[model samples]
Target: NAGVTQTPKFRILKIGQSMTLQCAQDMNHNYMYWYRQDPGMGLKLIYYSVGAGITDKGEVPNGYNVSRSTTEDFPLRLELAAPSQTSVYFCASSSGLSNEQFFGPGTRLTVL
Candidate 1:
């Protein structure tokens, strides 16, 4: 089964535009998360969901939103993109048993 997948491996967006980053996991995990990594910085959690219909904002959720209507899918929406939002975004999932998360390849977004 596919562990996790993210669409649009790379994207270039003009400032103030909007986009949605898709994420999917076939592992039936109970928890899913969205993270962003900036140049020379560590990964920062953007949003997370504990299960279907249960979602929460993470450390950096200012420019984004998320919905988890199913265990396999969690999509992140960028309402109004900004240059500060330019980073590599990663989707992750975990069964919550061992508390280890499996991450997707990542989506590189550039805002000019």
Candidate 2:
């Protein structure tokens, strides 16, 4: 049912380039989050928003930006991407009524 979807499953960006990773959910979740996973490490939260027009930085929000304009869409933007930004980005959403979260396939971005 495509509970959640992320575009450009894989991408390679040159240093200093910029791109946005798109994510959407059809479950009408109220909480959305963006996270990055580096090699051999656990997922690190990048940003999160409780609802539309509300957002807050997470543990690793240094080079990323995010916006929740609607309950369905939450996109992550990387400006002037650097080598350190190369990793897999994931988008997740939760109904806020429980402790469970639904995740997308993830976007693997490589900043070369």
Candidate 3:
């Protein structure tokens, strides 16, 4: 799969629980990113990786964490999930920062 793929598609989380949203791509991309889209809204960056072992936090990284140990994977860890964390998550990848990304379908998470 050269394109990014997200797991579970949808999830329900309790107020203080945790979950890891999986993301992966086989396109040999150097830039991988995680973003959240509010209900019917645009996307907001959460984290990004330029390559293996090089990761950076994006605009909305307060509730999430990411690691880039391999070029094919860029997973997001949500610890002590809160109601504010409930949103649709998307994983995207590009050959480089100057390039356009290929987006995955999305992971919809709800906190109750």
Candidate 3 lDDT by residue in tens digits, 5-102: 99879999999999999999989999999999998889999999999999998998997889999999999999899999999999999998789999
The regions of model 2 sitting more than 4 angstroms off are: none
For candidate 1, what is the TM-score? Answer: 0.97
Cα error of candidate 2 at position 83, Å? 0.1
Give the Cα lDDT of each candidate. Answer: 0.95, 0.93, 0.93
Q: Model 1 lDDT vs. the true structure?
A: 0.95
- lDDT for 80 in candidate 3 is 94
What are the runs in model 3 whose C-alpha is more than 4 Å off?
A: none
Worst 10 residues of 3 by lDDT: 1-10
Q: After superposing candidate 1, which stretches have Cα over 4 Å from the reference?
A: none
Model 3 scores what on Cα lDDT?
A: 0.93
Order the candidate numbers by TM-score, best to worst.
1, 2, 3
Q: What overall lDDT, based on C-alpha atoms, would model 2 receive against the true structure?
A: 0.93
Error in Å for residue 33 of model 1:
0.3
* Candidate with maximal lDDT: 1
Model 2: per-residue Cα lDDT at residue 41: 92
Q: How many clashes show up in model 3?
A: 0
